[model samples]
Target: MKYTFYLKKTLSFFLFIPFLFFSCKKECKLSPAECHVYENSGSDCTKTKEKNAPVVASLKEIIHPISGSDPTLNMEELSAIGDYIGSAYFVGLGEATHGTREFFQMKDRLFRYLVQNHGFKVMGFEATWGGALYVNQYVLQGIGTAKKTVRKMKFWTWETEEVIALVEWMRAYNLAHPDEEPLQFYGFDMQSVDEEYFWIKDYLSDLDLDLFNSIDTLLKPYVSVADYQTYPSLSETRKNKFKADLVKAKKLFENKESNLVALSSQQEYDLIHQAFVIFIQNEDILDPKFGKGRDFYMARNSEWIRNYVQPRTKVALWAHNGHVTKGDFWAEGAELYEAHAGNYKVIGFSFSKGSFQAYQPKGVGLTTNNVVEEMDCQTVNALMADVGEDNYYIIFDELESTSAAYKYFHKKNPFFMLGSVFYPDSQNTFISLVNLPEHYDILIYFKESHFAKPY
Candidate 1:
């Protein structure tokens, strides 16, 4: 949720500026009063007498050791995850750092496992909703090359060789399952509106030229915003007018909903309506006066996908650990989804140390750097390292209540939560503190991480 990378370089950063300036600074230290209570709840972080002994012993028992993160490997080791998923509707797969090779590969691997075993039909990303539709076109219809489509999604974090591999795999899967419904890929985040706006104009133009012109004229003034730095300088009256125009656009969509659905499929009409909603969300989050953050709308956009866009289909969300955790930091929206969806499960990733790609400090551009070797006995990464497995995953809910691992999870621990931007020396600033049991249902840990190979 750090606004330092996406919009900082282009058009996506403005919406999350508030998050970078405000939420990113929040950290739960080893303070006595806040050591381990479940973030919103008052449950105590109980300590065990044996320190790491019992926890390590229990971890050794429950952890599912994997051969590697490679998706092509015999994935029989990942079969246990299906049992942990049970009947969950949404599986939020999170990455410790957006640019880690193994994390991306692991997610690509896990998603393949889920689709094959669990009948998961949809996958959503933390990307611009309208833009990712093209990627979906590549997956479902093979409309373009995977590398070019992935690059067009516009998030530098996702422009990687690992992701290209995933897209290629998805396309292959669809080809193999000729009789079945093909897998669906989409972006749930509503940070930018240019793609949505352009699509809407084209969609409406096909349906009704007058409607398209009216809506386009209403939205034209705001669409030219090329950067985040300029939006804050707009006068209040102008901002209010922009907000009003967005509402008018939505009303126009609503007034002709039945006709629109008649001309297009219900699904197409719904997508058009959602595009307007995203435009409003992009406007609201970027507006300095609005209190709602990008995560707030992101949660809603994700729900919209689950409930309407791809109704009755199991969805796997791909995002950063900060956006997926049910903990309080930048999780206001994820918490909302957990409450409403009820069957949501989050899987968080971690690494002991390595290098990752991130935008250079102050948003100069992309660079890869090794993380400083920082570790603490109380942190989750160190505890997982104590287990001595190069790669393993643990499902917290599967552990017995009396087990040392369960008690260890009950306590708050520092987690490696790097985003798309990094300051190697300022590790403490990005590593967040959270009760693992409350924030994530499953934890995947790798002993070392490497930078994602760029395509």
Candidate 2:
């Protein structure tokens, strides 16, 4: 009995020994400078700063500070950082406001550098599949009345003077290079009903026609015959009802509008958008397959880069900074690098300090002069004054943060839904308004704050 008790005690001691060993181990919390030195140069924590060494700023300083400024670098230093970057993604918050001259100048310089040194390919502002198709059409054929019609109706911001300039540049590039495919620009967005469904007749076969007709019949009763005949602009009540019904149908279908039976009329517009999503998600349904959305499109783009763009290609993805920002919805933060499979080195361009603040353009009774007043910040007026009016740009800021400022703005102006849809998750990940991921990259407080930026 004594021997057995001793053996049991020894076993307990062995088990406890491992636990104590692990418990006693200390985790070293290194400063950013120490982390940088250790990671980059294999330096120990006791080492002093070297002469002419790179200055390392703390992550806190970068995230929260009086002014989050870029490193003060001369042309040589700028060139060194530029050289380190292989491909760059520029996300414009909105259209250039009057006071953001410095921002634009830097962006322009970056563009020129990518073109001159990196052999960069430019992707433009079209976000829908049809818009991308139209761009390709324009590349093949010069701008004509057809192009203008598509631009006016389908494309949102193409009407902007700045975007027009970019389009003109693309046209000139195409004209100059009659043989080479003008720097490939394709939209990675889903098709909208108003833009592409009417054109389906041109692309669909007899089988597709039958399927579409069958779906239309299934969905016909949900939309009243009178709703079909009513002109969209006839009355506010009629328009609202039409939109409400569509929203209802969208909800009923579990956000799968396309899976439902289709019907004719403006009321059936929501169904069309749904069908597009379904079609893309299930590409096997189409006889001649084409992928849609960023997931498939970016995958294809990656292949294009590997094959054609690999040896010597620098590409600039001119997209919303929201998409490129660290915490953006599609590919931002650590997930972004993981999503890309580390094939492309991605850097986001953001406005460090400017007059730009995101507010709802629609629904709000806002003009260029009153935008700053609508925001939560008290220093907005001063910031606007500091930036000046001539060089600024206005961009549609998508505020995804769930802070007091965001909540206050949304609560006061509930009509400004800001293009978001809420759904419950098993993890209860989205607990409150704050649970949503922030959409903007870097808010460029533009020098002047009034210009209307792009979405």
Candidate 3:
């Protein structure tokens, strides 16, 4: 059950930052006004006809301190963020999967800032909930004794460094604050016994033993005591019916290919979805003692936030940038955040090279070692000329920009479009879905020039 790393490539240049470096190199500079475009823009400049347009408000941007300097945030900024402590916030890690030095450094800084300044006590991630609980329990018993055992276990689709670092951080935090309640780390993704069975095997040993015994009993009815090994053969009519049904189930499971290896993508998706649905509906058949399953977990997560954190504590979730982004797949019609309503504030953190350039107006003289551009309405197009022609840009007018349209189409929920499957509904069906309003209160986009570069 151990998690494995599939290293895609070596570290990139952007990920070369050292932990001790208090600030970034001055390779380039932009005016404070230029750096904070949304803040400076008046109503006329910021307003757009798009319903998904970002809601902006002025807040001071913190500049990283110089070499050997301690990072600091002004009181006003700290107070503003503190006010939303009980609310859920989804913070995106910039270039996290790349496992670069800068990514680690930024993550550490953000973690410390949130804990010390923002009063966050819980840290949830994209990891498996049961596996995380197991790791925490093992670490609490003793790291020296538990390290090897913990390494052997697997949970979610995450790198070893990511989970190890998170667990270590929690362990260290608990050690330092002995009197405080231990901070919780959990996962929210729907669970499957096939996926999580390894984590709960010890607890269900007796159940497994009983089920095997029952299966042995059930098999006796179809076999004779004298020749059980050869069992009873089905009559020709029964055999045909069995084969026909098996073929039907196979077709439903595989979707198209006559052979097993070439299943359609939709078939794979349906298989995964069905596995989740079964786990949610049949907890009694799987875990007799607990009688808890997928639906219970999902409801618990929503209830925990609504009843516990939403009332008294602020929580932040570290997940994929897509989940936290205001209109992305994880945010569309997300019921968790809607439960909190006005009490919660979600913010997204993303990086985009284009966003920096987008700040420059139609015409202006821009000079950098990378390129030089003269002011004009087509500045963005001219600046990106060196980039390959196939590099596509997300033009707002080219697609539906509102969250509702994006979610309704991409998630393929018939309810979203009044049960219609044609015209605008079908046409926009390819758009990405997002967890509705709970996604983000602010989005940070970090842009780079090459697609191969770390995002």
Mark the regions of model 1 whose C-alpha exceeds 4 Å error after superposition: 1-51, 329-333, 362-364
- Candidate closest to the true structure, highest lDDT: 1
Superposing all C-alpha atoms, what RMSD in Å does each candidate have to the true structure?
A: 9.4, 23.6, 17.5
The sequence of per-residue lDDT tens digits that candidate 1 reaches over residues 1-455 is 11112112111110011111111114434332222111212222234224676788888998889988998877688877888787787888899888888999999998998898888877889988988877877777677788877766789888888988988898899789877666777898776787887778777888888888888888877888623676768888878888898899889879998988787656667767888998888888788477487888777877787765346778888999888887654573365555655578889998876667776565546765434243444567766887889999988888899987788788787665778876644556665677887878888998977778786
Residue 32 error for model 1, in Å? 31
Better of 1 and 3 by lDDT: 1
Instruction: Put the candidates in TM-score order, highest first.
Output: 1, 2, 3
Evaluated against the true structure, the overall lDDT of model 1 is 0.74
lDDT by residue for model 3 (1-455), tens: 12101000000100211112111123325532333211211223212312222211000112112121012323342333345443444333322122222233334445556776666665555444444444544434333423443333343123334345555666777668766544544444443233333332222233244432433342222212212122123444543443343234323433422332232222223322333333333332233333453333443353443233233444555544444333432341133445445544444332222211111133432211111111111112222222222222221212244533333223421111001011211222212333322344432222232111111
TM-score for all models, in order of appearance: 0.85, 0.44, 0.43
Q: Of the candidates numbered 2 and 3, which has the greater TM-score value?
A: 2
Residue 390, model 1: lDDT of 95
Question: Against the true structure, candidate 3 has what lDDT?
Answer: 0.33
Candidate 1, RMSD to the unseen true structure: 9.4
